[model samples]
Target chain A: MIDEKGILFILSGPSGVGKGTVRKALFEQDTNLKYSISMTTRTKREGGEQEGVDYFYRSHEQFEQMIHEKKMLEYAKYVGNYYGTPRQYVDEMIEKGHDVFLEIEVQGALQVKENFPQGVFIFLIPPSLEELKNRIVERGTETEDLIINRLKEARNEIEMMDKYDYVVVNDNIEDAVRKVQSIVQSEHCKRSRVAKQYKALLEVDDK
Target chain B: MIDEKGILFILSGPSGVGKGTVRKALFEQDTNLKYSISMTTRTKREGGEQEGVDYFYRSHEQFEQMIHEKKMLEYAKYVGNYYGTPRQYVDEMIEKGHDVFLEIEVQGALQVKENFPQGVFIFLIPPSLEELKNRIVERGTETEDLIINRLKEARNEIEMMDKYDYVVVNDNIEDAVRKVQSIVQSEHCKRSRVAKQYKALLEVDDK
Candidate 1:
């Protein structure tokens, strides 16, 4: 028995693990899922990304205001930008019975988990380090130094996999997508949520 | 990053909740899953059920002797017959990377959970009490009094739904089977297992 209150899913992975691509495929297939778009204080790069759709681009002051108001669920300083999850939109989607997915780095994921203890954490991994390096190099976006830096970061990320609730090895895109879909479907059947629904059904009092 | 040591899933539900029917559908879809056949001291019913397949139908003395030898995982008394899971076969299947499914009553499921705390517990429920009664009545093997008794037992079973790790409502067989399948698949991705695999993959010599 699934509750009206939706489950929160936290997805974390290395840069080359294809989390974004898998998420895109998942969203295209699952209409009920809502992505928790983070508010960032960084300028949107070229390609004409929208303010709200791509990211809720905010000023440093605005981001600071959000933090002071306790509106941010979890926030972090990454590179020169401040990225954070806004609590209101996520809560609204969950209240509307749509599962919310937050795509964040390992540090932000840990923060989200600490705040929302009931959230399900999933760590994505590449099939092998060599494969991960190949995928990163194939992207052609990063320089040699950046690629090496990413590989180092990936090693650090892999070590933090134990903090997650589940891990999906991105050996194949389709298989990884299926594994994530299965994880989300399975989390909905968790006993804490189901027991509450069952208890409510029993308390119907058929007089 | 699923390991060679597969998980054990304990599935429990009332008789008419379609546990066996769903299990059949699951096995048909996923051949990797191995069902744990219980060892019993009861005579095989007249439908030509084979030994070690339907059940390992042993003599009362043999069952008692095995119990004394501590070979059984969890045993129960049912209708003047003894039924229990043999630990060796289940352990072997799990060690060989076959996820094992044990279909048992709530009591047996609880005992298995107590012993193996990490085992995934799934409870199947009918859509409604009326639907459950209809399914039971359709069987035509039981009198009205017996049907009433079964329903009462079902109510008791439902009370223990909280004890399970997951509760899947079997309104639609396909959907229910998909849910259970997802659960078993996702349990393989649990962080504890994945982290250990990740550590092994690091290949750094630990003196």
Candidate 2:
């Protein structure tokens, strides 16, 4: 039987699908889950996000050094900032029994899945394109051009849904969170793990 | 972008996991879902069970005839009686926008998956073996030996968990029903169906 180990959950979605809101709800309700902090080589914007909490902002040279040392699991460039997941910290968290949650874009999600074949990949989708556009407009942080770009990106992202192991539609926050929770709970009962446990138990009887 | 077509759901569980209760709750909430009436060769026991509603009880020769005619999708022998699903009725129900639900054993579920390939298979599990035993005992319909036999069979059935597309742990009735509902809803967003629809929509723009 596979021993009780930490599970890696990858959450990917378009910008306006409420993936962040659902992730926040999941963290608030689930005490055992840990949010993975990505390391980035960029100046922290005016937001008062902490160093080790929100992200591990580093110098570009330092990020390159880590990559050359084979320390980063996966990395990608967005605008001017270089963001990557550090292999060591995630492994340590898993060893300590924390279910790590990686929130990334569709491309990053595919990279993580390739690196860790056992990781659970979940794609969050909006109920409809109209709802997605409305949500993006409600945010009021982007102009019309940015919103349109996001929608175009969303159309492309939805095409990668088959690569994911599960899909959660964000029609309602509570419903989506419950669905993700149930998925994590059910994965623990997979036959590959449970069968081994049962075989060990049966061995005791034979003795 | 997938068209609004009903999907088939196959539910399988051990004898005492309260699948019947969960199914009842699901059907009560979602009137659009069609609970498949299985065809059986067993004689109807005296308890006000209706034919064509509860089950389509047929003679042994008639059941064999259906199987010979390739009308039965999958069949199995249980306690000297044969039970099978009629493909024609299920297909008609799906065409009419009703999701068909087949409640069967793990073996039957596997057979259905192999035959249909498009059917969604879900495995329902108890919270624990002790809870399962307690539920079976509470029924008070069988001898202690029979309960023991059922428990043993449950152990064997659970070993087949990996074969299922999704596993729902039935710790609470309402929660399990909600989980099943979410799974069915999310399945509609699968890329195999959605991507094709989206591609078709984009084709007009390409021209």
Candidate 3:
């Protein structure tokens, strides 16, 4: 992939589908990918959620300032908290031929698609709708009303997956990670991406 | 891939680019793929090339008859010998959801493209054109004119790679095989191929 612009890989899915777990597993193995840390105005979780590693902690005022300055590639408000991907860092890394990995919610992912239309969008799904419901139910703390609402939201998000380029059935972490890695590998070999390079290299006029 | 029709994977490149070696290496590790052994009118090579294993050797008259009967998927005459893929066997295997792998010449690969346009066409390339010429020259058996002619033929084939879906630089056998395997893995995840199944499975009206 040297001298070629690195591809942007966006992994997104509905809530409670283990996107975070799968993303963690994928990164544990693929050192070649640069994780694009997201900026958030929400409070970071207590357990080892360091700034820049888990999320770039920011004040609401600063988050709005970034939006006003056209700094964010995509942003969404969840529970009155600002969450967005920084544009400059991703653009700089990919320009240096380093593939950038982004794990986000469905809304932010769709927004990112508007800016980086050529980016590879992967939708992670539970094995079945029944499996998704079971996972939500097993969490055990949610009231019946909350559980029903989450399922309804999930159904809506599933419909939006038509916009994605690949779907990884998160039956397990290893398989999901492997499929994602294969997608990255295959995208690098895509004819549309590499054809010009090969043509330029081998189309000698020595005939 | 169960219940889904198998994909045809075509591995092709200019002569002396080592398509055969990479195909062998790929099959040795990935048994999920079924190699579509080609048929030929040429006499089997001396070193243990078995009938139906290496190739289904046929007489010139029989090969022509099969062609006349439209039994061949794609065929080309090489060095006065007719070589072609058996259409019936490949179709049966793919219908049963077994991926068929075909390693073939550039001309014949293009012919197969016309027939199975959905097939994944991967064009293997040498590290450099000079490297391709070096490989041919290192054989040290062909006349200088023959080597020049082969290089010219290779140049033309490389140009035809625009018709392919993927281009793998065969710098070494291992890397080439890995790239091909990745393509198969990723193709199985393509939205055009799997979206309907996912939509049906997840689209519930229980809201």
If the candidates were sorted by their lDDT against the true structure, best first, what order would they fall in? 3, 1, 2
Task: Report the lDDT tens digits of candidate 3 across residue range A66-144.
Answer: 9999899799888999888988889999999999999988988998999889899999988877788889899898999
Query: Recovered native contacts in candidate 3, as a fraction?
Result: 0.68
lDDT of 2 by residue, B128-189 (tens): 77778889999899799999899898888877776777767788988888878876766665
Which candidate gets the maximum lDDT versus the true structure? Answer: 3
- Decide which is better by lDDT, 1 or 2: 1
Ranking by DockQ: 3, 1, 2
Model 2 docking category: incorrect
Question: Candidate 2: deviation at residue A165, Å?
Answer: 3.4
Residue-level lDDT tens digits of model 1 in B1-207 = 435587899888887999888988999998888999899998889978999899999999999998899788789888999999988888998889888998887788888877677788999988777788899999889999999999888888888887889999899989999999999888877777667866566434221
Model 1 chain B weakest lDDT span, ten residues long: B198-207
Model 2: runs farther than 4 Å from truth?
A1-3, A16-18, A25-32, A43-48, A77-81, A125-162, A167-195, A198-207, B16-18, B21-32, B41-48, B76-82, B110-114, B124-162, B167-182, B198-207
**Which lDDT tens digits does candidate 1 get at residues A1-207?**
435588789888888888888888888888878999889999998989898798999999999999999898899888988999998888888888889998877878878877787888999888788888899999899999998899888888788887788888888878888998999998888887768777567445211
